[model samples]
Target: MTEPRICSDDYGILTSARDWLAAGREPALVTVLKTWGSSPRPPGSLLVMCRDAGHAGSVSGGCVEADLLERYRSGELGELPTRVDYGVNREEATRFGLPCGGRLELLVEALTDAAQLDELLAAMDAHRLLAREVDPASGRVRLRPAGPEPTFACGESGVTRVFGPAWRMLLIGAGHLSQYVSRLALMLDFDVIVCDPREEYARDWQVPGTRLVTLMPDDAVAAYTGHPRSIVLALTHDPKLDDLALLDALVSDAFYVGAIGSRRNCELRRRRLRDMGLPESQLQRLYAPVGLPIGSHTPPEIAVSILAEITALRNAAAPSAGARSITAA
Candidate 1:
């Protein structure tokens, strides 16, 4: 409510809030309580703001951001837990940059302490999923282990928000495609790890915020086996690398295992994996020709397609690459 500042990194918001609070600045945390129609961000999205106008994370993609910033700067938002709705009318929609008839509601809280944020960040650092509940009405706060990403609630005890382990992406190759994929994945909050045993490819590999490993793709896959949020993608297009990683990953608890290939090659790979005694069920789980069929032809475009499919799978919005639909799961 003080001064609205917003960025797009979900994981960085808590850290930013911690820093702002430590700096003796007024930090306000805003969450997308609900939405209607074509909203840029979905429910549970966060926008952490400070009195100095510094922001981390986003509630809306853009238009609404400017309005929030202006409102906050004008001190129109009083110092209290408040609810705000945007785009209720046609003019408001246009002014706030919402799509036709789009609407969203937000809950704003001026946080006083960083203790809970410290705990949440610690849990995430330890690779533990935790739900931090805040009772703005009573100032009672608590943190507890979280289950599979749940649809959080906002009620009498206030809001229960999930602060989970970073999503993991294992890229099997260090080529151009993997380079683009890794960069984009990091922006999406994926803890990216690239495995390419070829020394030639490894030498010049330099993508900040991503870890590179020189090992057989299968060996890399083994290390990530049973990871709940892991999405393994083989972009090398070499059978030795892609097939081996796919074999190991498909059998693991990894939610999404994918490989880049042509449509015809996808069928061939399926047959080969089938001959390797990989069952039909597990084979079905494989996302061959990995990515949504987006008519992608360049490395960056291909990277987007891949991430799009991964996002879909992460939300169970569609059946991985086996199907494609824009609707929510």
Candidate 2:
């Protein structure tokens, strides 16, 4: 007997939808199109619901899925791609359990073939960023290569949603602090890679969902497929190791390059790198003190600060006052 399949995350949703289609079930793929005011899910959130009421992913927290399923079951929803609105007013918001002032539009399209799903899933499996362009009026869709990030846009031309591999984090150490950072980065959907040549430190490193590299730190950076979606962190606190990684990372396209150290040590390291002939422009890219100025001490707290700063920069948001605060002694 064939075992049942398992699915998780956004990619898994499409995988499950493809499976349902293969089993002769017409599954409707729902995408949150536009949201006004407050919303349970963002504009790009996806949900795939089978004719049997089985569903994967979520457009709303849980408020509207049932009603959506009922509409499809009762034939209120059509085969052609169409748009539906929910919570247009206060009464409707209350009925759908949506927050006050919450309103959203959804585009639902029924899948009759697994061809497109197969193609998109293949691209994702190959770690290639891909975007799906959907024409709601014509029930047509096409795929194209996308940038390093996922983005959703809708306009007079229809809808475009980008999906692909997760961002990556390369930690140039397998020490205690690196352990905490790796775990947190994994939780945040980063493909974490920890590199350490020292068996003494690497032997005890066993963080699940993270790749361990025994290559020299500099060599690891070179082999990591440096790209705009990658980040490199030096947490060994050893100039010999961290400096080598930083030297290569700062010159690469990694979105963030950071080294964990005190102010004095950071300045000294910067001076050393500058003296080694690293251009002033490249030298400025180093996040020497690493993380935010949150004044974190312990390994876990320090991990939080590091990830928080990365998250802020990744989202292109300004650091909040609290995040920029130096904890009082």
Candidate 3:
């Protein structure tokens, strides 16, 4: 099985799309439109590969890429983009190594237009939701804004599905804790950015797959705009740094924002943020003394706790305020 890595998968797709557009090569993007019965990935997962750009995302374990690549190589698919289904029956299931009677489907479309690729890339960059439609007969795909309604295409040759928001995280410091957080967040498929202006901390920082900057906490917070899919964590104990970031995270669309501090310290910090024009309702979003009550003291252990809390919040789709409080003491 391909040990799935987020950076590898996401970057592969983005780079391949760009290269295909630049080289004027019309390539097909195959995404797992839907799955059923113990599939590896859920709905809306993607596997984008072309004759030129390898493959990104996975459909069924690892059994589908080689076949998809062969289809792309031969003229069987033609030059037009088409949505195709695989593993829809028992015989096909055994071929794909899907246990029992598992099945999967794909929307394969030869990306002939730069405009469609550009739009999808732009939506990804902005962390917005996008719904793409592809006709199996004509091999044409359409891009549009996604609505609240959940829709899936079941036809043999059409692809209709949503590409929701990108995973994102905001690290409030560039110190050791921030480094650990950033590294782990990348593994969890987050678009991570670390903010700190202290020269001592920013000078010797190095973590791959994370954006590092020396922006002030308040200014960095201004950039978040509180989107619903974001998570913010303040690692620095420095009041100036943690406070402003916490303030911004409290008001933004960030689903989780936490600060590292003792219980008493968290109380004081909350009071300060509340005094700084942050409403009581907004302040409720702040997750001070972050992480579950695991009695973690070491940096890595603390990081594990923090990541666990974030995962729980995401999977539950619950607000931070309503989450059960952690009493590490």
lDDT values, one for every candidate: 0.78, 0.82, 0.72
Q: Please write out the lDDT profile of model 3 over residues 143-232, one tens digit for every residue.
A: 888754343554666667765455678788888877777888888878787888999988888997777777788787677536666688
lDDT tens digits, residue span 28-61, model 1: 8888988888788888889888766778778887
Error of 3 at 112 (Å): 1.8
lDDT tens digits, residue span 24-107, model 2: 878999999999878988888999998799999899878799999999988898665889999999999888878867998999
Per-residue lDDT of 9 in model 3: 53
**Which of the two candidates, 1 or 3, achieves a greater lDDT against the reference?**
1
TM-score of every prediction relative to native: 0.78, 0.88, 0.77
Least accurate 10 contiguous residues by lDDT in model 1: 1-10
Cα displacement (Å) at residue 156, model 3: 14
- Which 10-residue window of candidate 3 scores lowest in summed lDDT? 1-10
Backbone collision count in every prediction? 1, 0, 5
